[model samples]
Target: MILYGGNVVKKAALWYILIICLRVSAKNGVTQDQVSSRTNTLFDDVDDTQKQLDNEVRERLAQPKTVWVIHIPTRFPVLQLEDLSVTEPTFINTALVRSRREYQLGNPELEDPIISNNTTPCENVEEESSSEEGNVCDSDRTESEKPSEPEKCEEQEEKPGDDWTFDTQHKWHENFPDCAGQSQSPVDLPIAGLIKTRGARKLLFVNYNEIPNNLTLIYNGRNVILTGNWPRDRTPAVYGGAAHSRRYLFHSLVVYWPSEHTIATLHYPMETQALHVSAEYGSFEEAVANSPKDPLAFLGVVNIYKFDSETQAGLRTIINSAQKCKKWSVSMKPMPLSVFSPPFKEYVCYQGSLPIPPCTESVLWMIRRRSLTVNRESSLAFHSMLLGDDPPQKVFIRVAQALNDRHIYFFR
Candidate 1:
C-alpha cells in the first residue's frame, strides 16, 4: 500500500500516468470529506478542459457539410469505443499516426512521406502544414483541436511537375522547343476548301474488331492514355490515307475534353487521338525519335463526339472504367475498337504534330468528316471522379495552332 497527501493530487495529478490494475483509493485514515475537498479543484480543471473539447466538436459538426470531404490519414470526428481496462486520466491520445498494436508502431527509415503523417489511406486531404498550433495530436496540452479541412480538388492537382504539364503548355517552348514548331498540331481543320482525293484504298484497320486480352488505362496527371496489347503480325494498323507506302500500327490513344482538332470554330464535347506509329519502327519511342521530319512515322486518327440522348455500351464501359482509374494505370477489361475507331466513309487528312508537348510535328491526321454522338454520363462520371460531385473544371485546352498554309486533304 502507498499513501500520498492531498498536496500531490493538487500539483500534478493530470500529469502523472497511472498503470492499469493499480488500485487508487482514499487513504486508510483519511475521511471522505477530506478526500473530496482535496480533489475538488483538480476535478474542476478536468471538467473545464473536457467541456471545451466537447463544445468544439459539436460546433464543427453543426457546420454545413460538403458533398465529399477528403481528409489525410482518416476522416474527421474519429469515433473510438471506451476501453475499460485502462485507468482514468484527464486525456487520451486518439490522433496517433501509427497505432502501436495495429501497425507495429514504429516507422521504418526513410518512410514514404505521404504515409508518414498517419498510415491512413488519404483521400481528398488538403494537406496544410502539420505544424499548425493546437492540432489534435497535442492531446496532452490541456487544449483540444481538429485536423485541417481539405482544400479544393483543383489545388491538390500537381502543377508544373518534373515532366511537361498541360497547365503550362504556353510556356512549353522553354523546355520542349518542338511545341513551338511551324507545323504544330491541333489546328483548325477548315473543311470547306480542303483538297480532294478519290479512290484511296488501304484505309484498312486490321484486328480493330478483335478485343485485346491485355489492356491498360493510365491517368497521367493531364490526360488519360489507353493502351492495347497488339500482337506483332496481327496488330491493328491503318494504311493508305496519308501514308504513301509505310504501314502504321497501333501506338496509343489520348483522351481530351473539348476536341483538340476543332471543325472550324466549333469545339465538340470530347475527342480521342488514336496515335499510330510506322510498323518499320521497332518501338513507339523509335517512331517518336524519328518524327521531327518523317511524316510516315506517326498517324493520328481523331474521333470527335458529343452527348446524345442514348448511351452506347462501349462508351459506357469506358466511362465506368475511367472513374476507377484514379491517378495511376489500371488493368482494364478488353473494350472493342468501335469505341475509338468508328466507321468513316470519308475522312479529312492533314499533316501536324502530336497534340501535347514534345509536340513532334510528324503525324498524318485522319479526322472523320462527321462528328459522332455518345452519352453525357461520361462527362459527369469524370467530373465526380476528378472533383467528387463538384462541377467539372473549365476547359484547359490548347487553342488551335496556326495551320501556317498547310494543306488539308479529303480522302474518299
Candidate 2:
C-alpha cells in the first residue's frame, strides 16, 4: 500500500521499523537468502511509493492551484516553494532564515501560507481554495516587520591599534595604492647592489649648529612630532647631493620605533625621519600638493638602543616630555636642532617617496648607514605612548617597498 500526504519524518520512522523487523526475523532462525529477499522486497515497496508521491506532487504543481507551498527539512535553510504568484516576488528570493522551528503549509481560509516565524504549520489546510478569496503567498508580517540582511561580522572595520596602526593602516597597496608606485620609501638596502662612490657633495646645514633650548613636542596620534616656527631667513636648509643647487628647507622631525619587519630587515631599534621640502615651495603643504616631481627629501636615521653606554640626551628629553603629555598632546620646550641632527655625514642616497599617505614620488632619500644609540629604558617608553586615543602602538614602521629599477648610491 502507498502512503499519501504524510510527513517525511513519518516515512523515515516506518523505514526504520521495517529494518528492525527484518533483523529480528533473521535472529529467529530465518535463512540468509530469506532475509536478503525480504530486504529487497521492502526496498522495492519504498521505491514504488516514492515514485507515486513524486507523480502526485508533479500533478498537483501543474494544476491551477490557488496556493502552493513546500517545506523540506535540509542542512541549510532553503525556501522550496516555486512559481509563487505574489505582487513582490523579489523578496521571495532564497532568504536564508536561520531558525530552529519547522515550517508547513497553512490553512487557505484564514490566510495564505506566507513565510513566517511561527513554530507550527497550518493545522487546518483545505484541499482547495479560490484565488479571489485572497489566497496569495507572501510574507505574513508587514514590510517593516521583516528582518534586515545580516551584517558581515568577519569584515569589521579596522579599529585603530587593533588590525590597523599609524604605519600599517596606510598600507602600501591595500589602503594606499600610491605606495606601490615606482618611487616608494624605506626600501631594503642589499649590500650587493650598493654603488660605493666618493662623496657626491656635502649637504650644507645652515644654523643647524645652534641648539634650541626649548622646542615644541606633540604626539600627533601617529608619531611624536617636534613642531617649531621656522625663521624666514635663518631656517636650517640642506643643498647639494642631487639637490641640483636648489635648497630644501627643514619641515619637522618624527620619531618612531622599528616594527618587527623593519628590525628584521634594517636591524634598527628606532628611526627618525627628518622631512624637508624644496625652498621653491613656500611651505611643506605647498610641496606636498605640488606635482609628484617636486623636490622633497627625507633624511632617515636609524638608532640602536644601548644599555651599556650613556643614553642619548636628545632622546631622553623627548621621552621625558612624552611621559607628561597624553595622546595627541603637544609640549613646547627647548629642543635644539642638534638633538635631531644626523650623527653620520655618510649616507645612501636613493630616489624614493614618503613612507606615509599620499606617497608622493620624486623624493631624495638620504638613509644614514651609521646608527645612533639611545637608552634602552627610554626606547621602551615609546610602547607606553598611545597614538591619539588609540591603543598603544609599540612600533611604527612601514613594510619595505619594491626596489624596482632604483639604484642605491653610497656617499661617505
Candidate 3:
C-alpha cells in the first residue's frame, strides 16, 4: 500500500484488532472465523517477494537526500595599487596613507607634532615669539614651508572582506556544471575557508558569533590598530525580509578528532533502538577512545577556540594547516522541512536565493523525516540577544524556497 494514502494508520490498527479477536475466538468455544476473513481479505496472487518489494519502495518514499549547488563569478576587476612589493608601490600603502590623513583631521587630540609638523602653535611659543624676529619667523615659514604632506602611513592592503563584492552576471542552475560555470567566491572555494583535503576525511566549517568583537577585549595592551566595524550579518541573526526574524535557527560546528576503537557495535539510543546522541557515561574523549570504529560514531570533545575580531585573521592564516589534515567532515543530520517551510499554511511551495552570498539558486529543498523541537522560551532568549526588544519578537529565518525540478538526496 502507498505509505501516504489516507486511512493507512486506520487499516494498520484494524489488522491488529482482527488478530487479537481471532486468538480470543479460538480460546473460547466459538467457531473462529478464518484468518483471511478476520484480517481484511488477503491477496491470493501476491507472494512474499512482491510484498517485500512494496515495503522497500514505501520506505524509500519517506526520506530524501539534500544537495547544495554552489555558483561562481566571472571577470573580477583589478584593484588599483598605490604601492607594490619587490621594491615597488602597492595599493595597500596608498590606502593606508589616505586613511591616516582622514583620521588625523577627524581627531585633533590624536594629532602629534611628529605627524602634523607641530603646526599648532603652543601658547608659550606666542609669549617668546612676540618679538619682531619671532613674528617674522612665523610669517615667513607660514607660506614658504610646504604643507607637510600628511605623513604617509606604511600602507597595507585591505583584505578582501573589507572591500570586495561579487560579480553580477554569473548565475547558478539547479544542476551541476551549470552552477560550476559561475566561479566560486574566495570564501566559497573549498580550500579558502577550510584547508584542502589531507587524507580521507572532510573538515567542517564553523562560524563563531557568540564572541564579542570589541577591540579593547581583543587588544588589552597591543600596539596594533584595528579598523572597520564588524559586520552584524556575519553573526547569525534574523534579517527582516520574507521570513520573520523569529523563524531562523542557529547551528554550531565542531572539529572531528578520532581515537583508537576497541569494540564492534551497532549505534543506538539505549531505550528506543533509534539513532540518537549518546550520553557520555565517561568523558566524550573516553567514549571515542573506547568505542568501535564506525566513521559516523566517532564523537569526541573539541576545545572550542574563542573567535573574536583580533583572532579572526590569525585563525584564517592557520586554516591551511587544518586543511592539510586527512579528514574534515560536516554535520548532516536531517532537519525538518517544515522548520524551513514558509509561514503561510496554504502555500505548498516556493523558492529563493541562499541567504549567504553569492546567493545562488542551487538548493534541493527537502524538509525532514521528523520535526525538531524549539521550545518557546529557548527561542525567545536567543532572539532577545540578537534583535533586542526595540521591536516585538518576530519569525526570523526565510521560509524554504522551492525545490524546482532539482533532485533531492536523502541520507537513509
Q: Number of the top candidate by lDDT?
A: 1
What are the models' TM-scores? 0.58, 0.53, 0.18
Tell how far residue 84 is off in model 1, in angstroms.
86
Predictions: Cα RMSD each: 34.3, 36.3, 32.0
Q: What's the CA error at residue 255 for candidate 3, in Å?
A: 17
Q: What's the residue-level lDDT of 397 in candidate 3?
A: 24
lDDT (10s digit) by residue, model 3, range 1-412: 5666658887889999999998897765344334445442245336656989999999999878889886531111121212111221232243543334221211123223112222322211112111222112222344433122212223233434222111222332322222332222111101011111112111111122223242110110101121212234433222111121211222222111010110011110100000111222223233334333311121111111111112111111112112111122211112211111111111001122222233333211111111112223323333343233334433222222233432211111
**lDDT by residue for model 1 (1-412), tens:** 1346666775565455442213345352243345455444566768879999999999999999779887641101122322222223243233432232111101122222212223322111112212222111122224222212212112123446347756678899888888899988898765245555554454666666566766776665567667888568767777754565568888787777767876534566677788888888998779878875565578888876555443333334455566443365656756446445554445667778877777888888888654444447666665455443334553446879999978766654
In Å, residue 153's CA in model 1 sits off its true spot by 20
- CA-lDDT, candidates in order: 0.58, 0.51, 0.23
Of candidate 3, the 10-residue stretch with the lowest lDDT total is 266-275
- Order of the predicted models by TM-score, top scorer first: 1, 2, 3
For residue 369, model 2's alpha carbon misses the true position, in angstroms, by 2.6
Better of 1 and 3 by TM-score: 1
lDDT of 1 at 339: 42
> What lDDT score is found at residue 325 in candidate 3?
15
Tens-digit per-residue lDDT, 40-65, candidate 2: 45666688799999999999889884
